[model samples]
Structures are given as C-alpha cells and as structure tokens.
Target: MSTPLKPLPAWADVALIPLINVAAAFVISGFVVLAIGENPLEAVQILITGALGDLEGIGFTLYYATSFIFTGLAVAICFHAGLFNIGVEGQAYIAGLGAALAALYLGFLPGYSLVFVAIVAAALFGAAFAFIPGYLQAKRDSHIVITTIMFNYIASAIMGYLLVNVLRVPGQMNPETPGFPWNGRVPQFHEVLAKIGVHWPVTPFNLSFLLALLAALAVWLVIWRTRLGYEIRTVGANPTAAIYGGISPARITIVTTLLSGALAGGMAVNVILGEEHRLILEYTAGFGFVGIAVALMGRAHPVGIILAAILFGMLYQGGAELAFEKPKISRDMIVVIQGLVVLFAGALEHMFRKPVATLLARRTTQPPI
Candidate 1:
C-alpha cells in the first residue's frame, strides 16, 4: 500500500527539492569520508572552515563563484527557452581567443576602454560559435544536442591549432599567448577593497564578481519584465500555440542560444582579465560543464543559480583544502563527492519526487478541525 502524492508548493518545489537532494548527497559522501578513517562531522567542519574561515579563503571561494555564476546563468537562460545548450565549455574556450586578440591589438587604449572592447569581442565570438548550431536547429530541423556537442570538439580543435601555430608567443614553448600589457589588466579585489580603506587578504577575486551580480540582475529583468522574454517563454511552453499566436519558435531559439553563448563567453572576464591577464590553453577548466549541475540544482532561476553557484564554489575551494589537510583524501575523492551531487541533483532528480509528493498529498488531504 502506497500513499498518494501531491504537487508541492512553488517554494517547496524550488527550495526544498534541491535542498533534500543535496542533503542526501552529503549523507552518502559522509560514508566515504568515514571509510577513509576520517570523521565525517570533522570533515564537514574542515570544509566549511577551509572555504570561509578567513578573508583569503572567502576571496578564493568567491573567485571560483564568479565563473560559476556566469556559466550557471548561461545554462539557466537556455533551459528557460526549452533548449539544452552543452557547448558553453567550447564557447568559453573560443571566446578566450577573441579576448586575447583584443588585449593584444588594443593594448594602446586606456584600460577602461580596452576592457569594454575586450568584453564585446568575447561576447561576439561566443555568440558566433553558438550561432551555427542554433541556426541548424532552427532552420534545418537538426538536433541541438548533437550539433552543440559536436561544436565543442570543433572549437577545441580550432583553439589548439591557433594556440600552437598562430598565437604562440615566440620563444615560449608552452601553447599560450604572451601576457597582456599591465595597462589592460583589471584591478584585483584587494586593490579595490583598499580604495575604500578596507583591508583584505590577497586573493584572485576581482571586479568581475561584481559584473556577475549585474549580469544576474539584467537576466532577471530580461526574463520577467520584457515583452521579448514573454514571447520566448510562450514559444518554449508550446511551440504550435506560439506559432498560432505569431511567435516564431525558430527565431526565439536562435536568439536565446546566442544570448546563452554570450553569457558563457563573458566568463573570460574573470579568467583572462582578472586572474591570468593572458590567454592560455584550457582556461575554462570545466567551469562550463559544472554549470549544468549548477543550473539543475538552481531550478533554472537567476536567484537560485547564484545560490547554487556559491555552493559549488564552496565545494571546489573546500575540496582543495581537504586534499591538502588530509593526505588520505585525494582530489579524486572530492570529485566523487561532486559527482554524487550532480547525480542526485540532475540525473536522478526524481528519486525523491514521489516520496515528497506523497507527503504533500497527505498534508493537503487531512481534515481541518
């Protein structure tokens, strides 16, 4: 005999489900910690402290969070449009080329002006990378998933070729471009904090984190307050009905995907402009792939995505600390934990759905006395 399930409230659907999923993942991860002769509770404390114990840790956590925020928003936007865009990794990779090109050629401009041009270049290149797959899906009835995945490989290959042949710095064996001029370098977080008479630890965090916040606000406004957003949602909800209502699904798909790619490209601001100050091979470092997990855990909302990105940043920074503090726990162990999180939050999301629904159904059906 099974209890019937009911739909959860909006708040529960958005907040509770993901929380439950994350809790379950952590519980399972606890066992792995215990198996390695470490106390799970102690491990949890270490993770929290290592990620947020001091200004330095906090800065690094936020540094990682900035990238996740950009990629998460990119994924969330595409999800809203009923599109599965998996090319963010490749898009960011390709966008780095454009950013590097801008830095190389526009070094003569003032720092602020050069930064603006570099940002536009990255967005344009990323959008152009995604445009072909989007066009194919919209006009040629091609599967977006396949085309986007293939594009990732193509982008990677192109990047490799350019790095090795065209952009490789002379006398530098590594496959990378020369460092951008100091004038083009973005200010670091500590420098900004100093301006306000606030002492802060040295870390890789920078102004790009603030840009991520602005992007989130912009996304919220675009998705909820604009006419174009309404048309996008309409087409995503029901394509045939949208067509009847004079909304073109194909056009919306292409536009949404281009927007998604541009957002992903903007991640280079944190990497190229803020931290590296140069273009390097594989600079994206899997942030784009992790974004899918962030979007899933966030339920594809901008606010939710920001929270989820912070959580992932904690995982990344804390996981590194764990590896250092306890030699018994290797980096691969942290990866396992991350994998479990994504597994429960995304691939196995329904594991708790029926049970939650049943509980909600019971609550709603009880007699009011």
Candidate 2:
C-alpha cells in the first residue's frame, strides 16, 4: 500500500492552497486567451482596470458580489453538514416569488416594514421549498443530488407557468410582475450616499450589500461559535460518531438544509428588492450555480467566501468590459475563464495537495520519517 501523504499546516490548507489554485486557473486561462491571438497580459490589465478603475465599476462589482455572498454562504452551510445541496437555484427562484408577492400584495404596510416582511417571506419560501428534498434525504435514503437536480427543472417550469398565467401584467408580452411600489425597494446605494452629500455613481448596488456582509458575520458566529455549529461539524465529520455523541444526524441534516435554503433566498432580496425593484423571470441569471464554485473556492469559510465572491464579481464586471473592448473575445469566452476557475477549485482541487505537502514536509526540520 502507498504511504499516506503528510498533512499541511492550517494556513497552507485553508489559504495557501486555494490561492495557488486560483492562480493556476488564471495562468491556464491566459494560455487559452493566447490561443485566440489575444495578448494575455493586456487582457489581465483590462480585467483589473474594468473591475476596479472607477466608482461605477466598484459599485457594479459589489452589486454582483452581494448576490454571490448570499449564495456562497448557503452552499457553505450545506457543505458543513456533509450535504451537497444543488437545489439552491430553485430555492432562490421561489424566493423571488415570495419577495415579489410581499412587495406587491403588502402595499398597505409601512415603507421599509414591508421590505422586512418581504425578506422574511423570501426565507420562508426558500426553506419550504428545500424542505421536500431535505425530508427525502433524511427519511427515505434518497440521494440529494438527484432530487435537487430534478427540483431545478421543476422550479423553472413552475416559475414559467406562474409568470405567464398569473403574474404577468395584462397586455404585456413580457412574463414578469408589475413594478413594485417605490417604498418597497431596499434603498439604493447611490441614492443613500447622495442623501449624505456624497456623489457616488449610479449602479445596481444597494443596501443589500450591507446585509450580505452582516449575513457573513452571522454565518461565522453560527458555524464556529455555537453549540449547534459544533453539532453540525461533528455530524459532517462523521455521522456515526455524531450519533454516538447524542446528536441526531437526521435533525442536523434537516436544520442545516433549511438554513442553507434560507440563505439562498437572501439572494433574491439582493437582486429583486434591492436592484430590479421588480420581479423578472430571468432575475437570478445563474448566480445560484456560481455560488457552488464560490463555496468550493472559499473552502466553505465566510472570509474565503467574501473574497471569492468579490473575485467572481470582478470577473463578471471585467468580463463584460472585455467583451466590449475586444471583438475577438465573446461572452462565451468569459464563461470559459469562470469554468476554468471552477474546474481548478472543485474537481481538481486536490491535484496539487500531495505535491505541496511533500514539499512542505521535506523542508520541515526533522520531518522525514
């Protein structure tokens, strides 16, 4: 039998490895760029400039990051429970319905009060939708991956039916709800800054960015500092051991999945209430799928998630600029870049770990065994 590889230090495992993976992914992406007769260096400069060169760029990057952060945290929560919940896309979709309904039907409530209700309704909707798969996984020994995949199609069909037959405004061809009341919106970032006499450029960013940060802090506290968190980690590490330690794996599975789905719902509040201020069929725009990569790249940690989200936000904003400036590079090429990152970060994540650990082990004093 092959000898087991040496273990890495905590810093190396959590921070160093992920950074190297991202860098490697980028380097590979550069080669892909070169294949298309584009200057990789110029592309890198353009990406950096477009993502952070001005207030407009920064605002748009953060707006994208806000949605990513919510979805990343949702995936992270499920990761810690040893559950790969891929149904967040559907959960977030249903969540938009809840947020839209609250804003549309609850127009009688006070301004931000209705916003709060929409947020709660969003969480409830997401959680309720997720409960079905969670229930099956816990009780019926069903595979979460399969069920969640099926639910994604189900969600899209349901949303299509509802948007066309029920929510679409009369005499309009678009399948979307009427514009929400002005007060129902979460305050826009530029408007809020303008209120304080700071002239910031207009972007899709809004108060929901602050909420995303708060959610990250809350996830950290809940995951690392609480008894429930300990139980979750314990269960994830080894469900058999957790059962022996008086923790019910079934209960943890249900609760963790619920929390995951709720966080997924928060993405809707960021996009629908904070940005669009209207319910659109394509509002989600694949952010749920992006969250999986964010979670993986982040190593299922809040700090990592924030950084990863921002990096993806940069890619999104910068990629748009890239497509605009370079006729040779299409939007589909940008997706290839993102896919490379995901490939390095997920399936091929451990490709370098053994080599890295071997190197580190050789360098350590008195390490050879």
Best by TM-score: 2
lDDT of each: 0.88, 0.92
Off by over 4 Å in 2: 1-6, 366-369
Q: How far is candidate 1 from the true structure (C-alpha RMSD, Å)?
A: 1.8
Alpha-carbon deviation at 55 in model 2, angstroms: 0.9
Model 2 per-residue lDDT tens digits across residues 1-369: 976766899899889899889999999999999999999999989888899999999999999999999999999998998999899899999999999999999999986799999999999999888888888999998988899889988989999999999999999999999999987888988899998899999899999888899999999999899999999999999999999999999899889889988999999999999988888886789999999999999999999999999999999999999989987888999999999999999999998898899888768756557
| Candidate 2 lDDT | 0.92
Count of clashing pairs, candidate 1: 2
Please give the distance, in angstroms, between residue 256's alpha carbon in candidate 2 and its true position after superposition: 0.9
- Residue lDDT tens for model 1, 1-369: 954455678888888889999999999999999998998898888888999999988999999999999999888888888899999999888888888899889988975788778888888898889888899999999988899899889988998899899999888899998988876666798998899999999898988898899989988898889988888788778889999999999999999989988998778888997899988888998999999999999888888889889989999999899888888888899889999999999998878988888888878789999
lDDT of 1 at 259: 90
For model 2 the TM-score comes to 0.96
10 residues in a row with least lDDT, candidate 2: 360-369
- Which RMSD values do the candidates have, in order? 1.8, 2.2
lDDT (C-alpha) at residue 283 in model 2: 78
